[model samples]
Target: MKAYRMLTEDEVLQLKSQSCLADDWNNVLVSSDFNTAYVHHTRFSGNVKLGSFDGEFTLKGGIKKHAGLRHVTLHNVTVGDCCCIENIQNYIANYEIGDHTFIENVDIILVDGLSKFGNGVEVAVLNETGGREVLINDKLSAHQAYILALYRHRPELINRIKEITDFYSNKHASDKGAIGSHVMIVNTGSIKNVRIGDYCYIEGTCRLKNGSINSNADAPVHIGYGVICEDFIISSGSHVDDGTMLSRCFVGQACQLGHNYSASDSLFFSNCQGENGEACAIFAGPFTVTHHKSTLLIAGMFSFMNAGSGSNQSNHMYKLGPIHQGTLERGAKTTSDSYILWPARVGAFSLVMGRHVNHADTSNLPFSYLIEQGNTTYLVPGVNLRSVGTIRDAQKWPKRDKRKDPNKLDYINYNLLSPYTIQKMFKGREILKELKRVSGETSEIYSFQSAKIKNSSLNKGIGFYEIAIQKFLGNSIIKRLEGVDFKSCEEIRARLKPDTEIGLGEWVDVSGLIAPKSEVDKLLDGIENGDINRLDEMNTSFETMHQNYYTYEWTWAYNKIQEFYKLNSDEITVQDIINIVNQWKEAVIGLDKMVYADAKKEFSLSSMTGFGADGSREEKEQDFEQVRGVFESNPFVTAVLKHIDDKTVLGNELINRIGHLA
Candidate 1:
């Protein structure tokens, strides 16, 4: 607590001589060490408390400015020690400004009545028609928003979540807003009922209202020129600048929305980037990036997605209000100028290349391609598993994470072949086999879920899914027996047994955290039963699931191994283990070769057309090599080759170790 004292008569006369005026000298209270020499051309009204202005701030280019109140009006405000408040066009009211904060040329920063600072503001995300509303709060996470937006079928769960959020909001409600230490709000316009955090830099921002910038010294936030936010909660390490406008939004950690991007009623989770685009009521999970002008993302749910230039979606057929919504699972991408009518669900890691009006649901066929020809949707399943771009995307996600705060809100799983996608591949294989069985094996094409799949694509999809499954199961078994020196078949079987039974049935990607559905069901049950009532507890549950992922994954993979190989665990021998290892080796090698072939296309003759402009063919090849290195020397290609070599060695090592067990 600061020890405030009334200004001495001589000090008040000195302040008056310095052109500082107060409604009543008795209304102003100053710290014991306050100096009148630093008070100049300032006006004080209503009860005001001033701290000691004894520190000097060093600016760029070796300039120094003494910390004091100059040319400003403060009302019922408490100015902390060592702060410089200058040139306020209008009075700042009901604010507790912290130490070392510099507020200059700010117009009308005030808190009117009691404000929650944007908490309890319901952002209608995912579905624009107003059914799914995620309450914006400082503790909002991707998983919380996911359940709140998609779990509408369970009204009790939604109500419980809302109650929890409301409780949090009410707990933080305050009559006075705060500006934390080391903050700089310069040349801003009309900040009302906003709470700014420590180390935040707000310069040239316009009209921020009812928000909380949850910035801290560990991960500071920067709101730059011409930015406007209303009813928002921006988490730590985020930058909202360059005329970006937000309304009723919750931006998560390390997100960047700039370059005139406009978003309304959207929930953008960790590391999402939006530039020069407009989003309306979208639930953008972690790593959703849209960097194109005229690309509008509306009424959609997406995670780990990239929207190409001019990519768009329609949520209404003009029959009713905009009531439809769609979901693009993790790692999905849209090609330039592509469009999708809503009420559709694109599977994880799928590529959409053209306009499609039909509401095709490919949730069971992950890692596929959806193309449109003659207004007909064509599905090519499991092809993306071998694409060099897909591999690069999966590799880049973890590397691209921008969240620097130690208290990260999102639990992101970066594995491309987890139980989530593997379960989809399993269903896809079954669907393909069923199609082949129903429509004779000689059929040229098969129709599924309003999309057509050619016989060749179907067969290739089966092979691709098999390779992926083999790779996953083999990986699990190898890891399970990684360091075990088995001397007999009994030991091998015992080692192959799962350590837990938590991952037996289905699994789901809850935004980015991939866990078994049964575990999620238990969490949901707890939430519904009112056992898990706090946001912190819910996040802890998610963290527990994330920490135990490999254990749960082994359980799922163990069951799949028995079903896929038709092997009983007790009767399995070293030869069976060796057979599985050989299959895993082949699958690994085959996939690497496929990725290498796909990468070679980047160096193909057709791809070199625009490389050496106005040059002969030989010169073009030379220029192409200079720009994009040779296929074998390409980094991704080299990695693929190295992966093949390492997998071969690993398989041999495992075989040699298991060979002694026989």
Candidate 2:
């Protein structure tokens, strides 16, 4: 807060000579060190405060501009030291422009009446109807939005959370907006009732109204050419540009929305990307991406998912409103030109191809393929477990996290094989077995959930689920006994006990944070009972859950061990450990082999058809090898091979260590 003094008569006279005008000289206040030379052709109205202009800005291409006010109208505005404001088509009113900031060629920057700057804006996510609205705030995380959108049955809980959000919003509601220090607003249009943060860069933005650009020096927000945002909160480390338009949206940390993407009533969380597409009433959780022009993601809930070119969904039945929605759970992907009629649920890590209106609910069957044949949805369960693409996706999500803010808003878990999906496999195995039993074993096709599963796919699915389940159980047990040397069966049992007691019963993937459903229920219960009263408190709870995920996962895994391995904890022996280790080796090695083979398919002769445009067969092979590389030397194939060797050695070492007890 710099001290300001009234302009002396002589200084006012000099300002008049410099073509600067003030409605009343007495109403204008300036810093003691303010220079009249830097103030030129600027008109001031109402009560205005001006800071000293004593510096210069060196911009791109060696262009230099002295810090000053020129050709601009200031109405009840306070200009900080060393700032430049010029070429405003309309006046900047009721704004406190910060130090060293630059504003040029902007239409207007002002606050009218009172505003919360996009806070508490209800984004009607996952449902086109108004019921499942999420009040998007600056601190809105994916998990919080998940609860607000999905747990609509709990009215009291929703009311309490909404009230909390409203209170937080009202706390920041102000009659005067602020443009933070070191900010740049160039070639922009209107910025009304908006708050711009420190180090933000706004260039060529058409209209920004009733929004908060929560940028900071740590992770500056960038709004590039032809962007239009209304009723939005663009979080730190995000980039919105290239003719993108957003309405009633919350763009979370490090997200990118560009290439003429348009979104309305949507909530996009950390690391989500939208380009050349449209999203309506969608909850795009962490890492959700859609990168094609014809893609329309409407009335859906997605996380760690991708929408291929021309992918679309329809929710309206033409009878009722667009009330139906769908969930493409974590790590789901749709192929090019694929379509789904909503109110369906695709399992985690599943792949969708072709068009389907059957509304198959494959939520219990993770890692499956929903292929359409003659408009029939053919559910091939658990086959994606061996797809090289799935492994690559799982490995890349963590590496691709774009959040640069030290203060992260979302706590993302990138694990592909947590208890969440494993439990689904456990249930999926049962579902497939039940399907096989109810339908005769010799049946050609099994009809389940409006989709048909061929007998071969069903049997293969059961086998796939069994292998994955055994792998998870074995991996968990090995991890439990990783560093410990057990002398007796009692010691082994004690070591295998869970580190915590919270993760029991059902587990859920709350957006990206996988945890026991009981624990999430506990958090919800807290919110309903008024114990958790603040947004930060909810975030803290999620961070706690994220931090202690492995501990909670082990607890869930321990409880499942009894049912999976048929082990009696009290009477377990070293031979049982040996048996599990042997099974683990087979499952791990066999899965790796499948993935390796899948990777080879990409480097096959058929895949290299177009590599060499004009060449002989040998030249074509050479060109293909140069472009795609040999399959054996590919990074993913090498990784898979290494994983097989590593897991084989790991199981053998464990067996050798525990063989002493026998």
Candidate 3:
């Protein structure tokens, strides 16, 4: 650190000649190479330090009018090299401006008092009033925030986590604000108690109060025209532009908030896009996107979810103060004009249609449709299992991950069928069976969790869940024995055995990361015991669990093999393998046919209504075919047919292998 030095007597006289005044020239210090040639029409107040201005910077947009610092005051400020601080309508006090930064036509960039720049701002996510407030920080991940917001019942765990977050916040607390290197704050209004990071673009922003724009060179944040943010931490690579308003929000990596979208007390994780919509007190985990103007997402937890136009939720019953909340689990979708009453839980990959007053909880029955019949909520389970859109969404999420930064805060798992949903399927099958058992199986309709399930829907749901279960287990068994050349039955049996027994039981989807319930419990226990104190360490545990998913999945699948085949592992015959293979082949083909039939609905006459706007029927058919290629040649259809062929060959090959042993 260089020693602070006062301006020379001659320099002070030269500044006096130029009508510049300093509160005691001794209070102002500058680097040895600081040039007074560029310090024209500038005033210094309180304690100020100036770095060397020897470095030249070529500003973007070819407006090189850099020799002005008129009508601006600096206090206890350290101005770095090549920074043009001009037309600051109000003073910039207690700040450190970095090199190559352009601060032109800005109003009041100041740190009024001791500020942490919104590091420890508590956001009451689920419950609006209080009780479950998450202390947001620079490194807050979705999993950490999830646990902190939802697990408030365990006070000790919450306190321990809060203490850790407080420690982090205290470590970052500073007496002065910082404007990082290469930042441009041109034509902005009112930046108070905020920290601007490196390479950030804050142009024409209305106001930024008490926040941290965590922009960097790799993924710079762009706060464009009319943006207003308060008590926020916008992570790297995000764009908050075009009249967007944010309050008490944690905008995650590579997320886009634009086009008048307003969010308050929401946590939007990686790759979440909000355009022309409004979100309030929502926990938007990774890839929760809503681009419709009329959509309003309030008081919910969602991930990989797409909200259709006019899709909304009711958080108030006119009794309590907006107390109710809902959970639309991962990959859940809503059609246009769809509505759900709060205190509801829609399962993973489920599709919701129309308005329903009944607060249905279908958390165990994933891939279902919750449709409204008259005023009744009708639940159809496992129908979305073969949906091409579901598969396409799963495939697209990974490709659309926009985080260019090396350090990813969110750990997202994009598997369509994991132990998380599979375990739910297991429970869902039991729940349906129990529904039938209780209703006598001959009932016309069954009631469950504020929703009605028709008799045919119940039977079809059971069949679908069974098929999915068998498919998953058979897939695991086949994968386990994929590369192994089993010359004998003993070798095949040995190969089928799981490497580890840790993943035999229930599984959970903690936001995006899917792991066995036992593992999550261990992590929570670790946090409770002060073992997993650091946030990074906790995230590493999550990563470890995610990495070991396949291993644990095999363990769970291996245990279910005997139950599915009705053969004890100790007394297995070669015919058991043949029987399972034949069953697997049947399930695979059956699902394919259903998917094919579902795909055909897309090419129906009803689907061609809007196509060929002014054309005859023949032209309409041609236009529809031209726009959406012939069904036989469609990629998904071809893939389905090829899947049938491949599975047939695979089953026949397995049967042949078993026949040799017989």
Residue by residue across 258-344, what tens digits does model 1's lDDT show? Answer: 999999999999999999999999999999999999899999999999999999999999999799999999999999999999989
- Model 2 residue runs over 4 Å out of place are none
The candidate with the higher lDDT, 1 or 2, is 1
Q: What would the TM-scores of all predictions be?
A: 0.98, 0.98, 0.94
- Candidate number with the higher lDDT (2 or 3): 2
lDDT of 2 by residue, 1-662 (tens): 57899999899999999999999999999999999999889899999999989999988899999999899999999999999888999899999989999999999889999999999998888777788999989899999999998898999999999999999999999999999999999999999999999999999999999999999989999999999999999999999999999999999999999999999999999999999999999999999999999999999999999999999999888889799999999999999999999889999999999998988899999999999999999999999999999999999999999888999988888887889999899899999999988888999999988999999999999999989988988898898898887778788888887877998888888888887888899999999999999999999999999999888888888778787888777877889889988998999999999998898889888988888889899999999998888888888889999999999999999998889887
Model 3 misplacement above 4 A: 1-6, 10-19, 54-61, 65-71, 570-582, 633-635, 638-662
User: Number of the top candidate by lDDT?
Assistant: 1
For model 3, residues 144-217, the per-residue Cα lDDT tens digits are 89889888778989999999899889888988999999998889999999999999999999999999999999
Best-to-worst ranking by lDDT: 1, 2, 3
The candidate, 2 or 3, that scores higher on TM-score is: 2
**CA RMSD of each candidate after superposition:** 1.2, 1.2, 2.5
